[model samples]
Target chain A: MAAATESFTDQAIEVAGLKVRVMQGGRGSPVVVLHHSTGGPGWIPLFERLSAQHTVVAPDMPGYGQSERPEWAREPRDLAILMNAAIDRLGLTGVTLVGLGFGGFVAAEMATMNPSRLKALVLVGAPGLQPEEGEIADQMMVDYEDYVKAGFRDEAAYTAVFGETAAQDIKTLWDFSREMTARLTWKPYMFNRRLAPLLKEVRTPTLIVWGEKDAVVPPACGRQYKRALPNARLEVVAGAGHLVELEEADRVAKLIAAHAAQA
Target chain B: MFIGYFTERPYQDPSSGYFGATGRDLTDLGMSNASYDPRLGAELYNRYLDEKVYAEEMGFDGLMLNEHHSTPFCMGGVMNVEAAILARITKKAKIVLLGNVLPIWDDPLWLAEELAEIDMISRGRLVTGWVRGTGRESVAHNAQPPFNWERFQEAHDFVVAAWTRPGPFRWEGEHYNYRYVNPWSRPYQQPHPPIWIPGVMSRNTVAWAAKHRYPYVMLATELEPTRQSYQYYDDQAKENGYESGTQNRGYLFKVHVDETEELAEAAARKYIQGPSNPFLEGNQGNVRPFIQNLPGLTSRTNLLPTVQSFALAASRGRLKEHEAATGKKAEAATASADKQDAADFLGTFTDQINKMSIITGTPKTVIPKVRHVLEYLRPGSIFFWDGDGAMTHEDSMRSLRLMGEEVIPAVREMGKSLDLSSPFEVDPRTNQPVA
Candidate 1:
């Protein structure tokens, strides 16, 4: 990620069709934060910092946090399509999409298909792009709570997930997950087997960061990403697995902050 | 030394019927509706074999074959056996068993020995493709849990050592162990056969392939991504400062050609509804640890991007469903009475999907199209999927024949006349400079 100005938190918006349990904080330019479907109160760390500088609009990304059930945004490409709808409805432009986990896939998709509206993108441990066979099958074994409990850096994030998230975030994430599952498994499990082609079209300055310990979507994914995307860079954080932002919340968030501050 | 690619599909046409026709059958069926017939599959396999023979005779650098389950799209089942068959059939062309599920099969020694036997049978004409099985495949094959790439990675290492280091050795790992790891049958090839890693657009796998300078044979990637991939591998090769892209190999766009583009397009369109659809559909994916784990037909980056773009387009309704319940335009029907048009959105989804899978045209036109893909992407070869779906024995045969006689000859002539030789001169027909 390029250099940026210092700031805190960003704005929030009520995206239509997306299940929203709650919303908060606004300031400066708008940058949407999409969290991976691994589930939790969302990537609030990135928002906690960016919200101060820009209007950090972070949604649980239907089936993620306090967000409402999405009709059916199946794969990474689907997530990008739905996000495009929300972005259009919210009338947000020059949006710098900062995504973590599967959300990184969506952000990359947005950058791929509709780069004009995007200011930049930050993807962390994104799946589907480098879709391979038998990746971290055990992690998929972990349910939302297990993921959340085992995922977060601090108890505060855990509390934020349970309290601020919709229907204690469960009802929404579950229902949204149901839709996501239908959308996902409708075929086999591929979300657009050829999403890599879009990387070249991606004009947005993309920052791909991964935790070294992030076994979910490892550092290798970041390297392939660096080669594929025209305007992209790879940053690897040590001692972080799939949950880098959570494990190294301060560091990952600060990384986002640095990218966000850049012109 | 040699790579063999076949477009054999494991499906029977309406004209024939049977299941598990060959040694490999599509087990672990996902949808109840997608059951397969083995007898018909054997018939199709024979037809595809004819094409492989034609490819070898046509003076192609190599002929390829692979595995697939349930559907004939391709998932190798006992590729070693298939390689043996190719070795028997073609005394000339390089016989490449595009792959075997290295991780899925519990024993690497068995895989190694089987490959060695095939190399002996082919008289030093086998290029091996190795990689981790997809999540679904792991579950289907009951492959020792999916996430353990390390185990498979270890197996790969063990297999290499078993081949490279000649000794009665003790091998122990989380996955497999052996008392006398060395094989009874050393491969006919001197340094064992060349290893080609078929990447599922996977970042790590691609990097590893690039880092090692293994000939990276890509299947099903689009024209643009092909360029990016070549650029990527080339950049890696250049950055790592390698003198040869030959050793850093590539392949582009699985296709089958006929006398005319119309004939080829017709054949492609036929499979578009069959293997192409299911292959793409099978690749769509789930977040389930099981599903995300597998790299299906989409292992090739070139093929994945097209699907991704189309996926984005479909989600946006940019490529609207072809028809409604009554089989009329969806939007127009919505404007009228009754909501059947709206109700049939899901069914219409299949139609929308067909738009992206098939790329049909005439031989002249397709020659340029193939060139466009080739010149732009510059893959070492093109593994034309000549037989797929219920591609009739005659049509599939026709595609192979035409591709060899008409397509290959014509493309080679065009290359010479135009001086449009590829950067990597592995393509033998043209007088291109080999890097």
Candidate 2:
């Protein structure tokens, strides 16, 4: 894998009258990244690696990160609509949509709504489908630090990404992001009951990825996503947790690159 | 002065293993009703109702009731039901609901109708109040936390409109919408019953209450901070073009009176013995920070002084320390010490008394403490929080008798000297000295 040395620039774009903070870089095909419930993790190693081959455009979902909050938006589907409008404003075509965790739910909704606009759909440790055996871990049950740590497989992995303790500003951002998540996804938790049926309608090529030890959303959710989408494949990354993209950025980026190339 | 009586109406089942040395130290949100006995619930509810009746006989001007959900700390989850009962059961004492959790109600029109009926049944003796409920209420009722304040404001408006306006009015709101808001029952009180607001923190609530000229009741907050909170209310009232007075302020605190100081102290110590509630100081169990301070429930930037104090105490691990101490005390008392001593270790009783958080003594000592509170805060209305935690029927009766016989008369004289007049006496609307 090439070194993740690609630099990205932050841009504020207006979508549906809401200011969306978008981080874009690199060249060639467009890969729009949707962030987790705790908002965007900035231009991380995964985005950098992806940007090396493709134009990686990561926008903080409305009400997350630097994006303007829409008080009227009350569900993942609402965010998905806003994101689709954002994609249209960015003038992107044949896009590879990559969603992480809560972002995955939004991505799936967007795909179900407009499958023809995307060349590929990638869901990483997402939680839009109700697991048949286990349940999605409730983020509101613990403190912000504990919830973030739960995303990683170990303390080392957590420290590597978020440091020993997050700064006060970062903690504040996490809290703000969680409030948005609570506003959008408090009921039925992170999953939409109608999503499973809607997923069966989407004909877009999809790649469902899960960590082997993903504790936040069960690995079985990956299999469910695979079964729901007609043209989808599942990949499990070993020794990773919910945040498989961050923990194994090189490997996941390689898989995405390979998948996007085929699409 | 409007003297009222209040209690958490705790579900004190000693067999539930939630009370005592050998019990599971359960937190407020963590408590499950799996061990709840309907038989005990029935008895406790009736007993509490009986006590309220006795309170009316004991000459309390009003009976204050509050609502909390999914917890044993307060059995009045649907406190309106108690208010409705009190309206019919008691003749003179105002049925004060302070208050219904506004944001939790999906339909405020229904709440309006309920209150209207209560007012009519009580011959217009109703003091309706509203609250922006805690995270527990939001979680229990599945109400959106981010829209709590909005929903509360909207709900209050809707209920008031429903009560005062003509029938068949179309209502469309951000949080609620109704095609027809006409209820057959209107409030017996002209222009509707007086609205009051009770709060511990949340500066926004205090300011809002002041703007509306509703009596802002400080619920057992520290004396100094309570004074400061009242000052904030006064400042807000001045900004809104009114000079606020004692009629616009109220205070509720734990005050237990008995024949002797020792007996009063023993019964008062039961305040921290039973199931833990985050609102109650010196609780045995720890509140989950995430659950207690749910995102968007209350803005962090808009907090009162006591919230910072609570945060500081939480950061210092005071709750954990209290739990550990209580656990050890329970273990040590297993062989010899009585049940009272075992539970007495739950909190520093002396500290609470010294801090004036909990006042306990015979009428003479307790009356002086009450006078001190009146002099310090000068609230027009006062509610003595009694018969809570694990205090028995006899213990509650003794306190009520002592309060009626001695403490209340002394407090009334003190109220006169302090120039305190309740909202009922002085119209909150016109800021008149007397209505």
True contacts kept of each: 0.04, 0.88
Clashing residue pairs found in predicted model 2: none
Worst 10 residues of 1 chain B by lDDT: B295-304
Model 1 chain A, TM-score vs. native: 0.76
Give interface RMSD (Å), model 2: 0.9
Candidate 1 at residue A247, lDDT? 60
lDDT of 1 by residue, A35-133 (tens): 666444443555566666677776656545556655434455666776787788677888878787767767777777778888878888876554443
- In candidate 1, residue A191 scores what lDDT? 42
lDDT (Cα, tens digit) per residue for candidate 2, span A1-263: 12256488889999888899998999989999998998886788898888889999999899998999998999999999999999999999999999999999999999999887799999999999889879999888788888889999999999987779876567767878999999999988999999999898998899999999999999989999999999999999988999898899899999999999998
Candidate achieving the largest DockQ: 2
- In order of appearance, the predictions have TM-scores of 0.53, 0.93
Q: After superposition, how far is residue B379 of candidate 2 from its true place, in Å?
A: 0.6
